[model samples]
Target: MKIALCVKQVPDTSDIKWTENNTMQREGVESIINPYDIYAIEAALKFKKNYNAEVTVFTMGPLQAVDMLKNIIALGIDRGVVISDRKFAGADTYATGITLSAAIKKELPDFDIILCGQFAIDGDTGQTGPCIANLLNIPQLTFIKDISEYNENSITASRFLDDGIELVKVKCPALLCMLKSDFEPSRALINGIIKAQNSDIKILTFEDLGLNPEDVGLKGSPTYVSKAFRPDIKHSGEKHYCLENNSGAQIIYDKMKEIGVFNG
Candidate 1:
């Protein structure tokens, strides 16, 4: 099995700060690989170890994101491919999916399986994986909790749902959006780290991928953020002292319900 694992680097949500110009102030902010992506990597590694498969990782981000890919390589996977370009900045899910599909086509021509996280923590949209599948014109299973069965020709997986789960069988040359429980990410091995440090990680630019400037990044994005602002704080402590099991409390609750607070 030749698998392609898509990973991404995201900003630390906890330390996200905005600049005076209303954009994210990335300086001094910590960044890490997307947590969900680790599950995808772990799944690919499992296939590599158990089935003697080949796993190649691909990441799309700035040049600095190479650090994350190097760390991924330290998990005993195969080589990593990075796609970074200034023209790819400010891409929404649609643009990102298109760009990644182009890169995947250019890089992994004979790949059989494509794996990605359910969603990125920074974006939280859960759209990129499916969009990539759409761009590739391949069948995809999203929110997959486990790969129940897989071989060179087909794959059976369990898709996570709100109340239950759905079983899906997809043909080869397919894409999957893996959930966190797909597998546990491995720790970096010393030998693997050394090999990763010595490996020549391939870097692809925008033109290298044969992308049109208008087909990516902010210019390619149809959805635009007109304005960004923080939600206003409306809750204020207004606790009233009352006896336990008091009818007054029930009355207040009923009044709040009448005003639609409870319903909302």
Candidate 2:
């Protein structure tokens, strides 16, 4: 089976920084694989283990993102592809999806399944996977908590919903937006690390993908941020004590009245 996992390199949430334009400041921050994408990786690895599948991981980022790709390869992915180009910078979810779809078609046209995280922590939009599916005109199963069965032709998985879980069976060549599962990503081994270090990461550019510059990056993004700022939150410590008696009830009533909790 040929499986493609769409991954992302994101800033560590604990040390997030924003640019003057309200975008993420990624230059000096420590970048790691998107935490949720780890689950997608784990799912792909599970397939490789159980079914002898070949997994290729893809990410769209700058040249610096190669390090993250190497780390993913060290996690036992068969290959890694980084779609890096200056035109891909500042791409919104729409442009990102378009670019990724084009890359996937150009590079791995025969892939059986595509997996991605439910959302990236930085944007928290959860739109890329579905958007890619739309662009590719393929079936999309989202909020997937578990993939129960798979084969060369179809996949059966349990999807998460607000109320309950639903069992879904979809044909092959589908995209899945995965949620974190009970299975954690394994640590890279020494041999795997060495292999990754020696592996040649395929770098794809805009020209290679045949994407027009006007249709990518900030230029293609329809949404714009007007302003970004951290809201000021303040806490006040005020306590009230009530005795266990009628007077206590009266005290509570009075406090409620004082705070306008009671109109009368």
User: Model 2 — which ten-residue stretch has the worst lDDT?
Assistant: 237-246
Top-scoring candidate (lDDT): 2
Which lDDT values do the candidates have, in the order given? 0.87, 0.89
Per-residue lDDT tens digits for candidate 2, residues 214-241, read 8888898877777777665867955556
Candidate 1 residues 96-140, lDDT tens each?
Answer: 998899988888878888999998988899999999989988899
Give the per-residue Cα lDDT of candidate 2 at 159.
92
- lDDT for 156 in candidate 2 is 94
Q: What is the lDDT of candidate 2?
A: 0.89
- Quote the positional error of residue 9 for candidate 1 in Å: 0.5
Clashes of 1: 0
State candidate 2's TM-score: 0.87
Number of colliding residue pairs in each model: 0, 0
